[model samples]
Target: MKRITSFILLLTLIIAMVFPAPFAFAAVTQSAPTTEVPTTEVVTTEVPTTEVPTTAAPTTEAATTEVATTEVPTTEANTTEAATTEAPMMTTAAPGTTNPDTVTILHTNDMHGRLDAEDGRVIGMAKLKTIKDNVQPTLMFDSGDAFQGLPLSNFSKGADMAKAMNAVGYDAMTVGNHEFDFGYAMAMQYKQLLNFPIISSNVYKDGKSVFAPSTIIEKNGKKFGVIGVTTPETATKTHPNNILGVTFLDPVASVTAEMKKLQGQVDAFIILSHLGIDSTTKLEWRGDNLMNNLASNKDFLNNAIIVLDGHSHSVIENGQLKNTALLAQTGTALANIGKVTFDLQGKNATNITASMIKEADTKDVTQDEAVKAIVETAKANFGKATSEVVFHNPVPLQGERSDVRTRETNLGNAIADAMEAYSETGFDTAGDFAVTNGGGIRASIDGNKDVTVGDIIKVLPFGNTITQIQVKGTDVVAMFEHALSAPTIEKDGQVGLDANGAFLHISKSIKVHYDLTKPAGERVYAIEVLNKQTNKFEPLQLDKTYKVVTNDFLAVGGDGYTMLGGPREEGPSLDTVVRNYFKAADMTAYQSTELQRILAGTASENVPGEVTTETPTTEAPTVEATTETPTTEAPTDEATTETPTTEAPTDEATMVEDTIETVTTEQPTSIQDTPAASVEVKHDNVIPFDQAVKQKDKSQHDAKAQTDKETAHQLPITGEAAGTGAAAIGLFGLGLYLIKRKSA
Candidate 1:
């Protein structure tokens, strides 16, 4: 009976071992009952792998019983095995870092027209090549003013500049104001030579496409979208005639529209602007004049991360605006190279920084052989085209700095004299006075050697053409007065007149004087027109018109000379005049000639300067008699006694007309608006220049407000783990359970 009972127990244990009770259980054990069994009741332990069925009794009760108990031990062993196996799965990485791709961006700006090193200073194409070779997968860009600076750039009308840029492998470039110097025809010629795109969003020609506004370039599996914008003032401030058929659009609006169109398609957005840096206002329009509008317009700067600025010739030394955008510029004339690097991940630019590398710093770096060869070839070609003697100055020619402008500097005198001589060769109606802008002189004439054509070119880098206009004696005084008054004056007490106004350097004998202390319009209190036959200064009659010699830039009213553009006789090209001047002077010892010689004969003769102790009570003079007839001959005779015309109207309609009127204005024609004109001369009844400057300042202030608002929503979710540890643990447990069941 005991054996039977044992056998039954053994069968039950066997069935339980075979079935495994569906879930993990402890072992069942049997022990002698009564003598303090050590609480060892029959403990049945079920193994998860297989259930033990009691009905499947072992042939021997003892054997079955032992097997059931052994199975209980095996169940405990399985649980230990599961725990050991699951531990390693807890030690693996979360995800996503096994393989990664890296993208690098290399950038540069403001390469001007420099094609080679100048006097040990690296200026041109070679410098850019060195940078590109050193940095792999580099992308090169120019902010603007890539052409129109040196003689080579000028003589070829920027064709050489374009060819050189193409040879150097520029990826893209923006149009600068200076591009208009040669007119749109030359611009198109340059465009044809370029291997890359000429990008400018604001300039439109012929009511159709002219140049590409933006271009997307891909390198190393990364897409970079570049947009370009020239200053809006280009249409009016630059060559109006060249841009006559084209329209200059607002930069902010253009960029905004472009960015919106390119939104998710590009990995990064970059703006190459000819609009100089605005350091004073940071995000405001301080330097390039576009900052005020750009800062206020949110849509324009939306996704743009960096701006490569030019035109102001400033340098940004490691600074950022609004903590997101960075601004950088290389000082003008290719003195420095600007470099910026972008670190990108997938489609986002994760980091950015910039530096200005001066030629001094890059001097030691090895020159790129390929770029050096291209420069040498260009130099040889430029040298072969012209052969002429150039004058030189031992001392650096000083620029006009004082408020009383002096047009006849050693440099200005030289250039003016050259132009006067050059023009007479072709046109019998040669000009009397030679005029040039103070800004055109780029370098000082130094050293004792004879100046070569290259030396002259270095000083007069902008290839401005000489032009002659016929103006009345009365109009000349009016133009001179306009240049001397108000905003034209420098902070210093000195008069800010250029040589044409301050000294009146003439090819033929002429005399003029001004009362220093007198208010602007009254400063030219005494003026004289000389009869070369008599060689004596005489009072200028209001009605008599005079033939004036100047550059084409001024004949077309360049540099706010609206009076010069009005009905006047046109003479020979200004370039011809300047070249003739140099030839006539036959200046063998270039350094010996001083600029003072030009003004030696025109010193003010009025003793102690005549001062009206009290304001003149005399009524305003009557309208001066002047005609718009174009003449080919110079009048040697002088006339007297003409009254001035009535004051011009100051209404907006008139002002707008004045803004766009033709370059010629005879007798200050009542300051009436002329819609047909292209330039508005503020000399008449327009708002003061100071007030205009103030209005520009206000626009910049509003732009900063928009930048702050757009970046407001991107607060970082920093420290929070992307996934949780509990979720990982649960996944591991499930995996382990599946493995165990499959193995069993």
Candidate 2:
């Protein structure tokens, strides 16, 4: 019995050795499933483990290939971990199935510092957050000018606006002219505080980009290249002193150069443009004009998908430019928010749809609690005196910005009269006429309504002072010609109104008639000046000199008037001037004068010479529209690599954590090191504003004088002095040699 039991125990031991533990078997199967066979090895080596769901089992050759590409990991263990922890980047590629990826872009432009709209119907950051929360695979961008309009924005020099935008989550923004309202230093400060990039391919400082030229962001395993473009007119649109060290390249040139760098690096291209769509804006600097210019090259436009534009406050929704790209812009003040959806198949955009959501329609939308808190804090900090009524408006003034910029309005006359009255007190002389640029007038008050100091400040925000300068009659005519030199739209061979900030608003002391049928310089047919000595209107003499009352801006060549010298004497601030005028006039019996200061004509007339287009000598660079085929090489597809990371929240106001399940790609090239217009730079020299102006003025004259002086001073010591010293040195050397020989 014992022998039999021993034999049975041995057999049992053999069986136990043959069959391993359940946990050991489990470990063998789960730990190295990625390395089981040739097929599994291929999957582990080439594909990302995160791309494949852990629950999905490969059933066919196609599924094997798909699973292989699911998640590419450096190690077998990492592959298993990725399969378990990471979400799939794409939907399962079933047999003979094609799926397109969808991406949503939310865009806003020209908010103009109206953060909290007095009218709830106007769109604000709060409503924007609600839409962002509902939308998936979304990105948010601003074309430009988020600040510099409302009291909230201006009071903080755009600091508060930056904070609010940061709280709401803006991915990127292009530079705008109004961004320079608080000066370049302030703009840089705002950019530093914001979480997103302030990008502009064309804007440069000291031979380097003021902001990054472009950024490549990935969503759903697809890459998008966003390029920023700002209008070259920013130089003139803002104060010359504001952007002292900045230079703006041609938008077309900058964009094409940047697009070449992003061609193979990104799946799609988008342009965040602050260049408005209006054709009359500064000689082909408009968005449409720029698109047409770029469309000349089909290859460049092939990758371009959309342009979000601002600056002219014109609305163009879902409009196709050159049939190559989609374009959209919401008018000023956030009345509407633009949205575009791109259906991408592989790397190409298969379909695109554009639309706008009006703020009024979104009244029931939920406001983001975080953004609401920020805005509330700003409003609470604003003083109560801003709402106090400073004076009563007997009648509604015709001072809407559009009207003031494009035509002669009664409000323009009243403002000009106030400036003239103030200038007379400062100069102690009767000036010819008070003139102001239309851009100086920002808002108008309703007639028979109580006007507050805040209202006046909004209308005249720049704080310019009344000043007087003596100018010749010929210079005055030249100034008038400059005022009317802007290109006007042609309607039946007659010039029609176009928006130009340099358009002049004059006081009652001058009467002028212009014929649109005539050439630009010869358009002025008649001019009459009120002779203060004779108290009657008389023909202006070209040689006669007149003391002109104008704003300090105009005196220093703020507009296009170069001959108009800088402010000779300063008076009260513009707002103060207007307030003093209001105090002197009877509040209950105020009446705006119906003055005929300017008359328009439709017929042609004879004139002297060809119209010269020379503007005042200012720091702004003159922009000319030109077309040239860019010779940039297309980028390679190896520029980007996909990763298993999720995208960050575009609108953080509503969501602090990123719940987005996506695939992000890292760009191989860094924009900071390689600017679009980069050149080998040895030094970053900053030229002082006044010194630069002086150097520019003396450049030609100093050339000859500098050369002569350099040539005369080329030799440090004269030949005659050298010859005498050489003879003395020879005698001393001989004496020393003789002494040395005697001593030896």
Candidate 3:
């Protein structure tokens, strides 16, 4: 009997080893003991893989490649993919979709008080609010500089903007330099009006935060920590008196401290930065500097996710920093709005996508009733003076700051001409020249458009009064020297022209030939005064005192021009001065004498002498007219004239033309609620994190690399666990082979 049992066991062992499928099935029914392999567990594993069987092949290949290249475990990728697939299965999903874990952020920056539509493009605040309501889980945020641009907001010292923002339901906003335009008290007043939080980690007064340093917002059970930063340039950029006691801290230090404060408290860290993208390019301390500085302290700032930036009027849809944070900046004047979508699972972001919506494309969008009412009311309040037609422009006027500051522009000439003509009419005396700072002319009139009081207000939004002052020719030289003396900031990697508001835009009565290549005071190579008496051009007399026309802002030492003493006496509102001038003067096509008044040349070589008293000259129109007897003709709302030759003078004119594109502002009779037709993803700008680390500090990178290397070398699982997993896989494969043999 023992011999017969041994033979049977040997025969069974051979059968199990060679063609064991039948035996394996029989063995499973017999249930040997605890050592027997569980067929049910193997089947359960197969069922999970079969659910998304099609994705498995590609996923495995991708996983293998990632592991080989990164030398890191691919478990995170697998977990993220699984979570993304399950996103659609949420119970309390976002409206119209099943993505509860995902949230949308609707953002704008540098709206600059653009309450009304322009060129039928800008959607205005009303439409923005409408769009925000439709996008589920959306948080609306403004990065700052929403004050002090349009007449509707500027006239009220930004109160109107505050009202509109309140109506739009802005979650938060940062402080911008323009916020201090009316002064700190007014800014605080506006802040009080806003329903949303005004936060800035950097700005301080008496060592206390000017506003809330950061705020914690909860949405759908997720905690978000948002910190704000303002530009350090606010010190010199705004009116000196406006921010008297305020101190702007370094953005890097402020952000780092905020990170520490909010470290364990929030799921995400977002920065509302008025610091723009280009620093060296703009010659200002910008977002790039902030990011670079933050990247230096990688250990502390690893949690920062996004930065909503402003201040340079830039458009960056998906700008990334070396610290693995995203940045979005919409262009100024509410021209564009940024949208960021974050898919968070648990406490970490699984995915992030960003894009910008252009206001011009927002034709389909509707205006929210509440916000529409607020905007309409604000416009109506300012409409009496704003809506009346003042003059007409046959050709487009260029009043862009960069153009007017860097060289002579037609809009500058027109404004100066009005000031000079107004000084004569209001004061009964014509000055030798009229000067207005480029910063004062904020907007330009579109060609073939009716110039309205609203248009003039937008251009000269400051409401400065015309001032007639008398200063020595030597002082004139000093003022001009000071005007151009403000050193040029960085522009496109080169120092071109200073962004100083003091850059002067002179009247047609004086011809200034300057060499920007030369140092500040030495830039003025020649100055000629158009003698009203001789009707001829003559060299400026340094010792002789001449009557000068300017705005009260400049006369009172505004923008570092103390040389031009306070206005002799207030003459008329600057907008009114220009309005009255155009009303009386002929509505002829005004062709800008390109490079005639302010000629840019080299100090080594004087501009080709064009001033010649040798030939008889035509009398310049008398700017001196008694205030009682207005000299201007009847003003027409819809005035048109024949187009004149618009060609520039010479090669020099070509250079200016190529450098500065003409800027024109077109106003529609009514504001339109333009909505974006579609959105286009501007490709991602991924900062090479490792390369950035290396560039920042070799020692830091080396230290980080050594740690990473050590971590990577360590096994993700214990040897026993890995061996058990391998043994299970081997047994499963062997079972499959035996089953196939038995079937054959």
Candidate 4:
């Protein structure tokens, strides 16, 4: 009998060695981010190898990839490392979806006062409230800078936004630089109108935090300690005057203090932060900086489970932190709503996951009636201003920060033209040349579309007034030098723009030729001012004082134009000047100019230069991160802004995909597709969608590698886990063999 049993056991061992159990192969998959996705379309994959199971596992019914859609960071200095930390963001189940123990946190950051839907791009506040309602046991919050962009929100000085937010049911919020755009007092009024707390732990006045540093929110039998902190750049990000009474204190000190106080009282700590992930931000002010700074404290990392980030308008759908905590951010404007879920194992919050719910995902969600009424009311009041047609544009007006800051775009041309023409109407005297800072042009206007007063304001949101300054030709040269001083890179064929808020855009009446290849201060080889008297170009005289028209920001030496100091004469705001410019019958339509104002050489004359192949490549507009957070020099908004830009609301759908493609090209295919993936798995079971359906396909790998270079983008699973997971299959098989032998 013993001999027979040994023979059977040996046979079993041989079988195990030849065909490993699928469970054994599944060990490595255990570390898959425990995030819970909503009901998502599933693509079934089958393992072709005979030894492995050919049957495809059903994709989780109620879960999606909990898809991250974490757009690649386009800001020159930032990387996915800042957002992803060491792992993909995780959650155990969908927020408010069938998980009784889970508490959902619905949040938005850098909404920038987008109250109405922009075609299908922005779902508007009503739809946002629907998302909030779909997820039960939920609490909502806005990180900061919510009500400052659109006319509907700003018309009542954010009171409209407050009413809308109240209709949607927000639990708490933090202050952002733009929150102070109206004034500190207005921000306080906004708080008063809010049904919930507006916490800003680090902002101070009279030696005390002006707002509560943190608040306790109770839901689903769980107590959450929510701590809020604003960016230190707030000191000057708003009109330096708006924040005069309030001081932005040390965030690190303020946050750590809150952590100590809230340790044992709450189930978890949620850091409501406006400090963006801008790489250009100072070490002390960057959100990533504050995250690392918190690690020094003993147990702070343990309790802080998630951070809902803003200020850079980054599209970090879901990301992990070094301390194993999670972080999430929705791109700016009401483009996406963020959902966070904490799965409770009794009273302890265990599995935490984050996901971004785009409008497409919420097609079935009904708009909240209350929020819709509030939004409609605000729009009805501002309808004439926002909806009235100013003029139709023949072509796209490129005012993308990455574009305007780096080159002389058509939008820049129109702005400068407006400032120069202001002399005929608003200006008391005629001006010779007009200059507008690249940073002041906040948005892009779609071509062949009806432009409106709201559209103009969207492009020039800063409310900078038109002003005149007498700049000597030598000072003009110096100011241009300052504009070109920001460091830049050359890519494709054109010199890629180094994003700078101070970059100058000269009017059509002036021409400055310089070589980007030349060193900083010595780049200009020639300078010419359009001789208004002769209607011709003439060499700029170093000592001659030229009547220069510019925005008040530059006139006040904002964006570091120290040479701009001169006698000032203020006129209407820049937006009004542009509005009047567009209203002109001759301005019925405008087109993108080839090399407006600034040029690499004289060849790019007023006649319009031919676009290089590389220039068209740069035309792939920076999405999400495109809207600058309107900070001091850092310009945070999950971007380098992704400072916001939209040519048409319909174009937004395609651009959303472009934003993904733009981000994915920066990521490699090999890392995203792990070898263990040789065994077919669903995206819901593993990482993001992968090109490699069958890991053994070398031809596919080669083709995918080349494809990823152009447009296909992907995200990688935890590399260390992937490598170990593959090895676990073999080890698991061997363990079965050993166990069978011992039993025999």
Residue 470, model 1: Cα distance from true site in angstroms? 1.8
The lDDT values for all models are: 0.46, 0.58, 0.58, 0.58
Cα lDDT, model 3, residue 14 = 56
Model 3: per-residue Cα lDDT over 1-744, one tens digit each: 544554555555555445523222221123556743211100011111111111001121121121121121122212111221011111122243356678688888878777765545466888887777776544668888886676776656677789888877777888887776665566777667887778776665543456766777776666777788887655544544455555565465566666666767777767898877542223224676555554455443444477788876666656554544667777677767788887766556645677877766788787788877877887777775467676667777776555655555677777787788766656746677899887677766787888777787667765556778889887887777777675544444544554445678887677665657777775665567767675566667777888998876566455556566533856645766777666665434245343446655554443233444432222223343433212221111101121011000000000011111111111112211111101111111211212232246667778899987676445254434445445545665655566555557
Per-residue CA lDDT of model 4 for 93-154, tens digit only, reads 23345656767778888776777766566778888877766565366888998877654566
TM-score of each: 0.58, 0.65, 0.64, 0.64
Measured with C-alpha atoms, the lDDT of residue 584 in candidate 1 is 40
lDDT of 1 by residue, 1-744 (tens): 544554555555455444433222222234766733111111111111111112211221122122233221122211111221111111112123222333333444444456667645545577666765565434677877776655555555566677767766677788777665555565665666777877776565544435566777766555667778775434333444555555544454455455555657676667788765422111222223333333334443433356777655555645344334556666556666667765667654445677666667766676677777766776676676444454433444433221112344444545555555444443446455555554444455554455555655555444344456678766777766654443222324443332221223343223344444556565554444434344333455566776666655455554445566653443333333343344345333233332222221212243322211222122111111123211311110001011011000000000010011111111121111111101111111111212333357567776766765555433332222212333445555555555555557
Cα error of candidate 4 at position 275, Å: 1.5
The residue-by-residue lDDT of candidate 2 on 324-409, one tens digit each, is 47777776677778888877765666467787777777877888888878777776665443565667777666655545555677
Please identify which of the two predictions, 1 or 4, would achieve the higher TM-score against the true structure.
4
Overall local distance difference test of candidate 3: 0.58
Instruction: Give candidates' CA RMSD values in order.
Output: 33.9, 31.7, 24.7, 20.8
TM-score winner: 2
**Candidate 4 Cα outliers beyond 4 Å, as residue runs:** 1-101, 343-350, 385-389, 400-402, 424-429, 446-450, 471-478, 485-495, 498-501, 513-527, 531-546, 559-567, 588-592, 600-744
RMSD of 4: 20.8
Error of 2 at 647 (Å): 42
* Pairs clashing within candidate 3: 283-490, 361-675, 361-676, 362-674, 362-675, 362-676, 363-675, 584-632, 584-633
Off by over 4 Å in 1: 1-110, 219-222, 236-241, 277-304, 342-352, 390-408, 420-432, 457-465, 481-534, 538-542, 566-576, 583-744
Better of 1 and 3 by TM-score: 3
